[model samples]
Target: MAEQLLDVIVRKRELQGDGVVVLDLTRADGAALPLFDAGAHVDIHIAPGLVRQYSLCSDPADASVYRLGVLKDPASRGGSAGVHAHLLEGRQVQISAPRNLFPLAEGATRSILLGGGIGITPMIAMAYALEQRGDAFELHYCGRSRNHSAFLAELGSAPFASKVVTHFDDEHGRLDLAAVLGQGRARVHMYTCGPAGFMDWVIDGARQQGYAEDHIHKEYFQAEVDASGEGFEVVAARSGKTVQVAEGQSILQALTAVGIDIPISCEQGVCGSCLCDVLEGEPDHRDVYLTDDEKAGNDQILVCCSRAKSKKLVLDI
Candidate 1:
């Protein structure tokens, strides 16, 4: 099914840090926005054929508005730069309903939230929910420096300030991933979001410390994928059409070229919006959206970034 887009007005736009911007969005009609859980993200339609995902960082109890922290990525392909340049106060925009790929584990005795750089967005929201429930949780925010970290002042003065610890590379050298996950992993769930290197360290360190795979949660804002591969043929079963997926093009692109519109957002395959069933073929999975087990099954594939390993693939489009 297609995602639901809502009309929202940028109530306020404030610069949080060096290159970060905080946007407060509310329904254009002043109606209450849809409720979202911690670790949820919404798709912002920046322009025609351009969409980006930003995590919700506001308190879940507050239904007045949704907050997002966007970093002006220097390597962005017009998403972040466009947002920073075009979106202004009182400007109306369209955003999709919140969708969560990362959520706190239920029945956990304790929680540890890790955020690096702009990744602190979702962690702020999680802290609110945990504090309100009187749950045992700790939030550790890591950044290059205080001036580069968004929400530093607000987090310091927050009610859960006592449970927050910040590490700045410029001052503290580097966060010891070993020491953080050294705590016994009994009934505890750990969540981390950050740059690829930081997140890899956290995940690897946790695994080395014997943390259960199910107890570790993460979300990636972007993925490093090589979608270009050997050419192959895809047979669209329902459409009764066959198309050649070239070496430099993705399956989603090939299908769309043939007038088949498969729901797609975040073309990098992190959103799982272009996932489709595979009747017969081995997919060379390149997406981070699927679990290892799911990829091993070979019954489904995220066409946006993944490709076919076999000569021909039958898709249940």
Candidate 2:
């Protein structure tokens, strides 16, 4: 999808919980924001070269402001830390129009939203949308603890408060997957987002309980790209530059090392943000964003994670 840039100002910033900050953003011109659905997110330009996607936690019906929760990640490469430290009230930040990779499933009789840690952001938005439609949906949110969890008051005070369930690492221990999802059936749709480990557990549990793969949806904030491809060479056809991709590095990294920057986000290959045209060569597509026909055509490749199946690839970068 094409991204349209929007200039916004941080209208308010508040500490939501331990290491978590919620920022209320509004258009720089003080206009109504674009309408967005549940599970929508925005790519905030945090620094000169740092852009990060954050789930919008505000009620979708509210077009006046966009609410985003950010967790200060100690292991952050730059995005989280930059947003946490530099993005304050009155700060000017560039944001992308909202995009939804984790939208609610259409025409579902029931929904179960599962979240872990910082993953609660999207779940909150889903709860708001579901409640507005008067749909029967339950939210199972797991965080480190009540102290570490963000938006407790907001999530609890929501009109569908009774459907919200909380699990704390400090008090209740880890979420018992089998116990919580034992009733998962194909008819009931499921949505999950969070850390890789947490999402894998939830998806696996639901699958084991007879939930069809199509009935379970997932969104990952960060994904460890599969660096298992053999080393290859990528030739930038237009730039006439060739770079050797080491076994552990991606084609995107190899190209960037030579000072050729390609727009990239969700390097995990979910957003189709780094898709590039393959001028001449085959690719070992390792992304979930591309459709089967797109992959079979081998005309475009997500350079963030996918690699060349041939020894070398001529790219239309």
Candidate 3:
């Protein structure tokens, strides 16, 4: 990977409750940074040993700086806590160019945004984009408590504030899945980001409500495992090489270890960037990106985090 040394000075920091820290970064090099669309995220080289992905929370029209919110997850693998504890004002860090996988679609008449806790990060940007285009939309933000919610003030100031509903588990109880889905009117396009369970719940509800698969969009904050087992061998037809993937490792990680370059985003298997042809063998479809018919055709698989079901599988790398 090509690495660049850029000094991203921390311009300001705000605590948005629930152990989440919002950091605003600006370039110290006095050069205009690359422009990014709403729902874009950047990879920050937190320290020599840590790299973390954070969504861009600022308006895309402003190229002066980038805003990111970090939640100090106690159960985290250390990345979140590191940002909260170590990243401070006046500190400089290196950041990758912004990348976006959750972009707003064109020609949608109306929008419905569902966000859970920190998952609101990207959805917030999408809401802004839709509002800028004068699109009608409603935002449903669910969290454990008001104190646990981030960007409450900003969300309340949005043009669609009256359309924004906040559901607190502590007060309002759990979100009424039925009510949210039943409120649908007009041709509404749905966008959601949250934990696996939350996403699954909304998706299932939408399906039951007769929402077309294309109309409901989602981004997973975590991977969902409906199945699990030991790994096997995968043959890349184009590279003409085979690699043995062991248990506990994803096929994408295994292939990359063997020096094969594949473009990938959201290694959690939500994004379809790492999709490749499955020329032969039964694939244990575990990714959310492909549909049932697509998987049944045995045409492609997401190598980033998917494993093989058969003892040996062939791929058109």
Per-residue lDDT tens digits of candidate 1, residues 140-255? 99999888788988898988999999999899888887787676577888999988788888889888988899999999887776966799999999999999999989999899
Q: What is the C-alpha lDDT of each candidate?
A: 0.90, 0.89, 0.80
Candidate 2 residue-wise lDDT, 129-227, digit = tens: 999999988899998879888889987788888999999898889888777776766578999998889998899999888887788988888776788
Residue 249 in model 1: lDDT: 91
Off by over 4 Å in 1: 1-3
| Top TM-score prediction, candidate number | 1
Indicate the residue-level lDDT of 210 in model 2. 88
Worst 10 residues of 3 by lDDT: 219-228
TM-score of 1: 0.96
RMSD of 2: 2.5
Candidate 2, poorest ten consecutive residues by summed lDDT:
178-187
Clashes in each model (backbone N, CA, C under 3 Å)? 0, 0, 0
Number of clashes in model 1?
0
lDDT of 1 at 224: 73
What are the TM-scores, per candidate, against the unseen true structure?
0.96, 0.90, 0.83
Candidate 3 lDDT, tens digit per residue, 42-71? 877777756767888776766888888888
